[model samples]
Every structure is written in C-alpha cells, then in structure tokens.
Target: MRTVLDFTPLYRSSVGFDRMLDLLDNASRVASVDNWPPYDIAKIGDADYRITMAVAGFAQDELTVTQEGNNLLVGGAKTGDDSGEYLHRGIAGRTFQRRFELADHVKVVDANLTNGLLTIDLKREIPEEMKPRQIEIGQASSPAQVSQIDQGQKAA
Candidate 1:
C-alpha cells in the first residue's frame, strides 16, 4: 500500500518553497525505482558531497556526466562488443542512467573513475549576498534628545 501526501494546503500558504515540495515528491517517486549499478551518496565535508557508483565493466569513455538546470545526470553505455564466450558471466554490462536533483546552490565540482568506481564530487557555494550577514545597530536620537544636547553644548 502506498500513501500519497496532499500538498495543496502547503502550496496555497507558502511561497518560494516549490522546489522543496518538488524534492519531496521526487524522493517518494524514486523509492520505487530499480537500483541498478548501485550507488552511494556520502557527505565528505560541511557542504561537500560525493556520489560513488559501482561500474565494474564501464570505461571512462563509456560514461557521461552532465548537469541541466538543477538536475545532475549520470549515464553509462557499453560500447564494446560482447562476443566473448563466457561460461558464466556475473558482471553486468547493461546501460544505466541516473538522475539526481540538486539543491539551489549545489554544483558539481569534479568526477573521477577509478578501480571500477565512478565518483562524483559536489559542493554547495552560497553567494555572499545570500549568506547571512550581521547588521550594525545604531542608536536613534529623537528631536527632544537632540535639542537637550544642543542646549547643554550652548551652556558649556
């Protein structure tokens, strides 16, 4: 049994949170998808993330990593021939495409393939204007206070 959450109420009362709602919906949808060429997502640093996928038989040329808008796409396609006679083939040579929805300021930093694993590094870079900043508070002087100071200065 699958339970669907209704976000109509949230949509009606919120603004600038559409992406968050969409991410929730996408997460629910991704739960039912097949886990092919298993992958792992880990956080290496405060704002750094890494995604490692097991691609035993895929070469660097056979894999592609691309980013479109707020989505990251990683795909692998076997280009070589499979005519070799194997008594028992255990390694999977199938093509796969995975999609990852990135948050607002997250970006792909680097990608490397080593030891039959494809690792993709990601980092979140918040702009200076978007980051939280402290504002200096200044003392406010009313007209009466200003007049009092002026009168005292004249007497002195």
Candidate 2:
C-alpha cells in the first residue's frame, strides 16, 4: 500500500526550511522500484561520510562520479561486447545512474573503483565564519555605579 502526504500547511508556517520540505515532498513522489546498482552510505566520523556502490563488470573508465552544488550523480555504462557466447547468463551489466542529495557544505573528497566496487568519500567542511565560536564576556560599568563613583569623587 502507498500513501501520499501533503505538506502545503507546513509551508505557510516555516521559513529557511524550503529545501528540507521539498526533499521530503520529492521523496514521497519518487518510486521505490527504480533502485539498482545497490549502494550504501555511512557516517564513519564527525563531519565525514562514505558511500560504497556495487558496480560489478564495469571498468573505471565506464563509470563516472560528479557533484554539482549539493547534488551527487553516479553513473555507469557498459561499452563494447564480449565475443564469447554465454548459454547461462546471470550477471547484470545494464547502465544505471544514481542521484544523491547532499547537505550544505558537504563535498566529495575522493572516489575509487576497485574489485568491482566503487567507494566515494565525502566530508562536510563548515566555513570558519559559520562554525560555532566562543565569545568572551567583559565587565561594563552601570549608569548607577558610575554616578555613585562621581558623587564619591565630588565629596572627596
């Protein structure tokens, strides 16, 4: 069973959350049956992430990884054909393209293809100005205290 959710009411009440709401809306509309070339995303440490995809029978040249803005695209295409005929073919070699939506400040650090597996590394690098910082507290003389000091000086 499939259910559709409406988010119009929340849209009118919130600010600075348009992207998050759009993501949620889009995810619900997308079909789950399009999943192919299985992949995994894991948060290995603070501000660090890893994505592993099973891309068997695909060469490094045939696969591509790209990141634009906050979106990541991974695609693979099989080129040429094997000469030998196979009576029983079980492996899949179809072309596939996968898209990943990344958060702000997240970047793709590296990607590697080995042993029919593709691994991508990502890190969220917050800007120095955006990071949380400590503010030093300083003492300030109140108006009443300053007046008291002035009166004491006058009496002296």
Model 2 ranges off by over 4 Å: 136-156
Worst 10-residue lDDT window for candidate 2 reads 27-36
* lDDT for 19 (candidate 1): 82
How well is each residue in 77-156 modelled by candidate 1, as lDDT tens digits?
Answer: 99998898999989998989999988889999999999999999999999999999999999898999999999999999
The TM-score obtained by model 1 is 0.83
Choose the strongest candidate by TM-score: 1
Question: RMSD in angstroms, candidate 2?
Answer: 5.8
State the lDDT at 79 in candidate 1: 99
List runs of model 1 lying over 4 Å from the truth: 30-32, 139-156
Candidate RMSDs in Å, in order, are 6.1, 5.8
TM-score per candidate: 0.83, 0.82
lDDT of 2 by residue, 2-112 (tens): 688888898899988988999998888877766689889999999999999999899999999999999999999999687888999878889999999999999999999
Relative to the true structure, candidate 2 reaches a TM of 0.82
